[model samples]
Target: MKKRVWRSGLMANQGFNFQKEHPGIALCGLDCYACPRYHTIGSSRCPGCAGKYFSEKHPSCGFISCAFKHGRLESCGLCPEIDTCNRITRLKTVIKDQPGYPSYQNRIANLIKIKGTGFEAFADTCIHKEALLKTLIDKYNDGRKKAFYCRAVQLLPLPDLENLLDENAKKGYKSVDDAALAVSNSLKELANKLGIEVC
Candidate 1:
């Protein structure tokens, strides 16, 4: 069988501009842009969970299939059963143990926020968060910290993240090393408070 490729306009180098298209938000509330796969180049690229591309790649994706069966809603948040769905609970349990996966709890939270605030507002929030995350990635990320940083951004409130970014900027750091050192403990503390793993 030919390999299936999900084609979302959001894939890097796939002619989709995330900042312009806002294609990073998935129906399950996964921030496709924040996933390392989304940033990957070449054949490993993913257009995100909401991408126009669908294939046998995820034959067991209950979220996708369920959404399709239920009026083709853009997100599970639209479903009245969202809070009580067994599939979502099962998926969350599976995702929680996966290292480097965006926080499942966070995904649900994003879904609720999206449902309450509307896609346009949610997309704007995502874009702003991405910008902040980019700043951290540019200034503090080493080869090993990418996943940790992504998780941190996902778990931290936007205001807290913005404050951290501002704090770093105010410190006049001279190098990535310096910036990382300055924020490492604080990041760890915040992660711990949220009961999230940073490593």
Candidate 2:
């Protein structure tokens, strides 16, 4: 069997067209454009984080595992405790007043309200989403909150995790456990950069 490698921008639907268009060549901090799995079908739509995109592929997103998914809501904003999740807390820290901050917050809140649960629920729903979940948890515990809510953050934004792995992979780690510890620390460093709460 040949090994299958997937990037963030590979897509099957070449005929798909992007309904949501960004007029100006504005760079959203996210690198969805670089993803090999984005709608390569020519649709301007982003399937990675878009709920609609997920619905197309039945059993598509980690959101289904989210508490909110079963709750019959779209996002966290509808939750009575929308302000309480660590994810939301971290987002507020770095995105304050940024052009897209408010919109991001609203999106998460809406997802929770509509989906009715924490992103962890969705993340745990699939193995593919597991790495992203761990990254988010690590970021939250470390103090960096910028990765909150946005699926893109959950996916490729693992600077801290990567650093630790890069260091450990080269260093003579005493054991696999030691390497794990290093990765944990990297996540902490990332959190510190974002001022996320370590609780």
Candidate 3:
């Protein structure tokens, strides 16, 4: 049997499993499953945002939608007008909570501006997830004392607002408890292990 080279858009390492030990947590608003990066990595499951996609069956992402539709942003990072971007602005809160988020977002922003797609850099990061995880863990621990280590935040499948409403008896409410929180905890722990300062 010939090996299947996973190719959604770009090239990637065959047999790479993105969801190895990850717990369910929606790290970003984007659907990782539809992301060309995840597709190329052989992940049938969306890294995060599966629940939302499952509900619409179209994988409607607030970030992607806003970028392509509302903001007219080819890419979130490429948006010439960042002030008009609610999606990126919303993410700012989440990014601010984590030590490593600003840098990551800036890096992605830079990549999006310079490189057409952010997936190439993401794919490279995924290629070294383990090493990166370890490094981040160390940095987290080290940063704790000084309070400035950027820990890797875990991304998981995000349930759509409809799904959340449905599960919540259609009250149209969602909370941190609605989705899995362990993934974030794990990511935080990993950062701590790496000696990254985190609170």
Error of 3 at 104 (Å): 11
Model 2: residues with Cα > 4 Å off, grouped in runs = 1-129, 132-167
lDDT of 3 by residue, 61-105 (tens): 454433334233333444555555565566667666665333343
| Model 1: lDDT of residue 8 | 29
Residue 109, candidate 3: alpha-carbon lDDT: 44
Evaluate model 1: give its TM-score.
Answer: 0.67
Tens digit of per-residue lDDT, candidate 2, span 1-199: 1233332222322212221122110011122322323423466544543334544644333322332332533333444554566655655574555554333333343344334554344333323333444443443323333234233333333554455545645667565455445555555566677765332
**Alpha-carbon lDDT of model 3:** 0.35
Error of 1 at 129 (Å): 1.4
Candidate 1 lDDT over 114-181, as tens digits, reads: 77877788887777877877777777865556666777776677887888778778787777777777
TM-score of each: 0.67, 0.27, 0.30
Error of 3 at 164 (Å): 40
Quality of model 1 by C-alpha lDDT: 0.67
Which scores greater on lDDT, model 2 or model 3? Answer: 2
Segments of candidate 1 deviating more than 4 angstroms: 1-22, 52-62, 65-72, 80-86, 89-102, 192-197
Question: Which ranges of candidate 3 are over 4 A from the true structure?
Answer: 1-60, 70-75, 94-119, 130-194, 197-199
Better of 1 and 3 by TM-score: 1
